[model samples]
Target: MRFPKILLIPVLTLLITACQTGYHLTNQGYSRVQVDSLAASADSGMARFLQPYNQQLGQTMNEVLVESAVPLNKARPESALNNLLADAMLQYGQQKLGQPVDCSHLNYGGIRTNLPQGPIRIGNIYEVMPFDNQLTLLTLKGSMLREFFEYFIGNQAEENALIVGGVRVTIKNNLLTSIEFTNGKTFDPNQNYTVLVSDYIANRGGGTAFLKDAVRRQDFPVTIRDVFIDYFRQLGKSGKPINPTTDGRITIQ
Candidate 1:
């Protein structure tokens, strides 16, 4: 194609301008929309299509499982929520693995929220434990158990890093004075104990270096939240509220 100088210059300029570039808005701001009490239907056909899924999810999330007579909050040294969760893990692990669950450890951060002293729902469990971490039954030697406790006491002091079940730890001046089971059996450093822990700890997610030397480990089919839900149901069937007490499991002096 033949073109004049002015025509060629303009054509080249148009070709250069055709290059794609992203828009970088310097004054970006959020736009708020009021969905409630809106004047218009605002896509009613789409809403109809999503109505079934919304109904199913709402029903599942709202079903009351049990009542929490006491608020299950996370605390350093110990907590009622921690006690309830740890007990549930131990019970579930013991029954599922067909073995004596000597102790269980629930990562303090893993419990995302606290259970209010009221009706506990399926959604409440989901909110408290919102992870896919499964139940891991680990067979640890007595030495490993000691290391676990030491790591728990030293590193987990601030957030109370781990809430334990089955074992009681008495701390004096920030030192472990006595180590015994919640039932009064003393810990033996030379013996092997089966404990229930989350796969998050077993997989080294939350600074659980103590669990690295586990002698034997068994992974369960369910998750921590599932165990809680199942236990909640079981207790509800027996008319027991979801109330667990801090029975000096982690005594501080």
Candidate 2:
């Protein structure tokens, strides 16, 4: 999908006080401090001293990359942030397994923060997806998938619905009246499909014990947070912003 136009904005810089100990300001007048070019030589002593640590830190965590055109958060049956997270995991897991991803299921509570519309920082990702949850691929039959949806529909009042992608559902009066894959094909009961899930739910089973019966459980090396961060970074290279909308995949009527 095409993202919104990319925009570059200046990073917010914080004012720092260089006092050795905590000091109370007696005067209210503004004071400026020199933060750069203190040394005349290109290879200054201070630069050399800090070079090793700075190089070690690298550009992985602090880089101001990726842009969000709209704020996304977990709302209810579906949310934009939840969609992106689920979609990101599904896409990444599929690539790792070299197979089609039929569905992705993650708990809404797993989503920690709203993705705001602005410069997406690696720090923001750390805040948003602050978990070491590993990704696991499972082979669940189509009937099990239906049973999974039923579990959610039966108890929609108490627990959060699974943040899902690659499938569409129509929940009417808490009953799943219609269901289909994103390709508009009905889930075949006899067919076994690749499912992506977080280690948390898969290990203990989800809202129901049906997930425990999934075949061919495979654990991946990377965390779910990295999958999301990597996807955001890839989108940054393509000039894509976080601009997902409600696709009506989970219609509540």
Candidate 3:
């Protein structure tokens, strides 16, 4: 009472200090590590369950596609899927290189798989062009074209060169006699023709030695994977189903 309200200040400060709570923090701790289940982590397990179903589904879809789509044998001269694939490569190559890509070709063996009869998928194309090869464009003159023809004939005279949109030929008695185009245009020997093709062929790995020429005038590096992707996407958009049919593109006679 002697110092009035000032006397109570010290007591209040002490009381506040005493009322504070303390946290008992610990330096050591325990952890419960979680491990993924066997089913989730094992790749073999996933493949074991999925492979059979994928094949069955592929087979059924292929059957359906074969029934509904246009047969290759009946398709117009350039309407075959193989031809279309080659054409797509040529177009892509031309756009990439800023030049006229004259023609495109693919080996029959390289077209390893066929389009299925039912629902076609990206996986189907992967099976068809499974290698990690790139698209290449070769500028060859008429003389080189003749050499290529000679080489191909020497290998398999009966089988015609599998070209896409720009060639007509007749094989006779194991000799390449007449080669023309749908437009009645003949291949000029002096004019340089830009051939859009696969890198494998350009490297002469696919049994055609003409591709081994020292002069690879220009090279456009493009992967076949991208080609197939674009092709599949277009097919899906158009709902234009395709079938595995043969044409005189590679004729026996």
Candidate 4:
């Protein structure tokens, strides 16, 4: 659901108008407008027309989806929010692909905000993951997977780290000392494993060129946001509050 930033204005306007007027928006045609040249002042008539729609949209966004037993914050190495998101991706990927996903990873930059300790709302999830990045599955030889972790460790920074799931990574002196699955199986260089990640990474975005070497790739139509939303809804229906915590999944020493 990625859209050019410039097109967002017109697309949002069409959505709001459709909601208010009961007229579906369609691809009629297109025209280029100099957005920078437009006047800064808000149009009074347009604002009045959009007020109700804005309120409705806001209400929908604010609807509570679930509750969190503890506040989840994103951080380097590991964090509660990171673990929750990565686990959700892993679970969703396995369910969607109808196969086991050895692991899951997400770029730290993709998560935009933190979740509060109480009720989690739809808008909160939207704020956390604004970009509609699709989930992708990659199958790689154990050797390539090891190389990927080495690169990930070498590039670690406060704002640049990968949120990981189903694996424990130990780093020493900025080197990946050891990596093993949570199930207690050590990494084997000859094995093939499936990893769940965002399409952005699969396409070699975020400077991860090695991802292009994946032995096999599968792109799912579902977005990461959709995955989280459904996960939260299921928890809500089951009257269970998410209580994610930071384990030693990724330890730096």
The candidate that achieves the highest TM-score relative to the unseen native structure: 1
Per-residue lDDT of model 3, residues 14-85, tens digit only: 889999997897798898777777435767888799999989877643432112264232122233666766
Query: Per-residue lDDT of 43-78 in model 2, one digit per residue for the tens?
Result: 678788998888767665678668888876778878
Deviation in Å, model 2, residue 169 alpha carbon: 0.9
lDDT of 2 at 62: 73
Off by over 4 Å in 4: 1-44, 183-186
Write one digit per residue (lDDT tens) for candidate 4, span 1-253. 7999999999999989888845576768878765552646678999999999999999989888898888889987789888888988888877766867899888888899999999999999999999989998999998988777766667766457857888888888766778789756668889898889899888988788987778999888998998988878777886888787778788888
Candidates in order have lDDT scores of 0.81, 0.76, 0.62, 0.84
TM-score of 2: 0.72
- Winner on TM-score between 1 and 3 is 1
Colliding residue pairs in candidate 2: none
Cα-based lDDT at residue 147, candidate 2: 74
What local lDDT score does residue 111 receive in model 3, on the 0 to 100 scale? 64
Model 4 CA lDDT for position 73? 91
Model 4 C-alpha lDDT versus the unseen true structure: 0.84
Error (Å) of candidate 3 at residue 176 is 2.5
Query: What local lDDT does model 1 show for residue 44?
Result: 83
Mark the 10 consecutive residues where model 4 has the least summed lDDT: 32-41
Which sequence of candidate numbers ranks them by lDDT, best first? 4, 1, 2, 3
Write out the backbone clash pairs for model 4.
none
